[model samples]
Target: MGEATDRSGGRDRFLDRLPWLLRWAVVGSACLLIVAAGVYVLARIAALLAPLTIALAATLFLAALLDPVANWLRRHRTPPALAALATLLLLLGLLVGAIVLVWRLTADQFSDLAKQLDQGLTRTRDFLTSALPISPGQLDEWTRRAVSGLRSSAPDPVTGAATVAEAAGALLLVLVLLFFLLKDGRPMWHWVLGRTSDRSRPMATHAGGAGWRTLGAYTRGTVMIAAIDAIGIGIALVILGVPLALPLAVITFLGGFVPIIGATVAGSVAVLVGLAAKGPTTALLVAAAVIAVQQLEGNLLEPLIMKRQVRLHPVVVLVAVTAGTLLGGIAGAFVSVPITAVVYNVLRTISEDRRAGAHAPTGAPADPPSRSGPGDATGVAGS
Candidate 1:
């Protein structure tokens, strides 16, 4: 009994001597581990439902972008379902029209782009041979081996066709989900809240509503930024007389969805095209223009537009995009920022609630006491 008492006493002393901050840190670490484990399990489930997950994500993105329009129509006395359907159809029509327009504008330039790329590659090889110690024969052999390797690893037609079919099916599923989400998303969210305890219901609602607004702002702002980038770069390319300017600008617009790397890649394409068709001076000018545009965007456009929507630091955005790409590829990169914003907003809401509760006064009466009590009159008389 004495030994047990001594052990218990020692343990108590050890705990007592621990710093309060250290104790909280330990608790915080455990909470972080639990959160990470939950996320891992969620990711595993998502992998199992890849197509459905993609559809759901795409639907959420579209709904975020179109919810305002639907709400406006609803306020104007349109039926909710009809409003959602109209919004979705209008978005789809615009998307299809944009695709067709880009296609028609670029179809004649495909051959030209290929020819320029081939010429560029040849010139690059010649430059390398002349500048370095490499013989033309050695460079030719390396190029031949690289081409052979690429050809060997390329997918067969059957596999490529199947992949295309899968993509089309996923796209169709996304459209269907988008329509329903825009129409019934509010009711769906309320139904989810209804399942939770009353204490948690308000927190969940606030987080969800705030997250949706953030997402909406992000989508709209990103589109505007991307358009500006494309137009700026496209106009510069045209002034410089770069070949394939239209196609490159369209690519730049699409690439904006992926954040930093997308614009870089698109701009690089413009530079290369210029190099092949318009020589070194034109290539240098195009590269300069691309850099200037990106610099302006990073410094001015994103800060102003995305400030209210996404409060993420540039480093956080880059890390999120990188991790998403590694884990989920292109689609992951595309949604990474929005997902991060939602998670951040949810955590912020929970933290704020906790802080407010902590600061609330204890032992407060539910209501003010009546002024007609005998004790109140006696106290007043004594004073």
Candidate 2:
């Protein structure tokens, strides 16, 4: 025991010999490396269970959006299972109604989309012929090449069928998960807390509560932002006399769910349609409108609306989206921002808790480590 103590003292003395800055730098780097390695392992596991991973992420998103309604019903004396069922049915009804409305509004416009595209291409070709050095024949060759490349890249019918089957399975899984989460989310949270270590449980509980609130805020804020974008762009299209205005508007609304790239693609589609049906002037106007709306959303709407919960810089959001896209494609992009936001909120909560604990006086009771413990009654932390 004496020798062991001496050896321990010697090791500590050696560590103390290192410069404070260097020692801290090494410690921090090691922590970061360990975190990175853990993240990599988790990512690999998620990739191996791609469908289940996506389904689970999607279920969490939906639960965040719908849990409030379920809870509200429960507060009104409805049974938990009944409240969950009602909420689910109501959501399903709304979705079906929206789909039917969109189909009825845009079916005829969709039929004319092919003709509009041809006209737009012809006009674009004519303009290029008049202004640029490229000949019509050269343009035709480029178009043929693009078309052939698309054909080559197309999946075989069996592959397409398999992909569709996977998507259907994932969708079904999401619904099942969402239902259970809504019905039993509070009880489930307690079960988790019960299993957690005594020292860690309070911290976990606080961070989790923070994360759930952040997610719910993000979900609602995003929906509002998307609706504004869709409305703004849709009105612009109608005023510009774009032929598929309604269809384009619906597309914009749907795309808005995907963030930066989604809105851009929707806008580009609108511009292409405008150029096809209404000529360059209308297309240019459509482009201007899209740019304006996106700028407004980025500059004003998001900052004001998402600021309270998300609090991420634009660069951070962009980096997260790009990394997710590179790692897991479109689904990755869809889920990345929310995951980042939740993780960030949880981390911030943990840091704040740690700081408070460190500063508190001895023998003074610490603030209830889980101040949000009572809030768990509302079932906000759904899955």
Candidate 3:
């Protein structure tokens, strides 16, 4: 009986530890599965969406940014659907007008560029004939070879057009998705909560609210900053006499939405155009203007607008941007900051909840005040 009791005690100890072991195993397995699933999904999405992914991401961002406007309209007695439609129409109209203006500007610039190219080619041929080591004929032969090589490597028009059509289809899908998301966002949240167990509903609600707020703040702040950048840079470029300045400004504005790298790319384009049309000195000035505008946007506008939304350290943002670039290129870069913001908010919410839960009462009675057993009247009288 003694031996049996000892064995039973040992078995109970093992059983107590069994749950811990299983828990660790379960957690590890879940983590591995999650990582694998994330990788697979990312790859699939990249392959399937490609270019349209950028537009889709932009749409979600815009939706989140514009959510407040929709809510305000609803508060003012407008239906959610109508509010969403109005916001969408307003945005679309502005975008279309901007695109038309840019298109016209770009067409004119291209015509001018073609004429310049012809003159430049003629001057290059004459210079080579008169002063270069290579004969004009040799130079011409080299140019022909380069052109042939480029033509050989060019994409087939039919295949390229089909690919473009596919991308357009994907873009249409994104628009449809964005519209539904904007219209049914609240209902979807409630539905998600309703589907969860009662025990988790409160946590879900808290987390959802935190996530939405973060996304909304990021979107709104980014848009305001982008607008400021666009206007400032547009004016600067126009003053610099940059060709296609309007189109370049529009591109800069749109690019600003993608954070660090986008602005740099757009600025490079502006500089190149400035160089082509107005000379190197003008290009340098344009580049400086780009830098000045970025500095203002980064230091002043962003901090003011995003202080309440995301307070990520510069290092954290840089790291996120780097990781995003590695993971999904431009789309990754665009989404990284928002994703980081969401993560930060989630962590904060979880920490707060944990602290609250830790401090909550457990319904146990407090221990009686310490005293000598059967305490004397004076409490100290007992010895």
lDDT of 2: 0.84
Q: Which stretches of candidate 1 lie over 4 Å from their true place?
A: 1-11, 16-29, 363-383
TM-score of each: 0.85, 0.91, 0.74
What lDDT score belongs to each candidate, Candidate 1 first? 0.77, 0.84, 0.72
The model with the greatest TM-score is 2
All-Cα superposition RMSD per candidate: 9.9, 2.5, 12.8
Per residue, candidate 2 scores C-alpha lDDT tens digits across 199-226 of 8887888888888888888888888888
TM-score of 2: 0.91
> Alpha carbon lDDT of residue 47, candidate 1?
69
- Model 1 lDDT tens row, 220-241: 7888889999999999998997
Could you give candidate 3's per-residue lDDT for residues 337-365 as a string of tens digits?
Answer: 88888878867765666666666679743
TM-score ranking of the models = 2, 1, 3
lDDT of model 3 at position 153 = 91
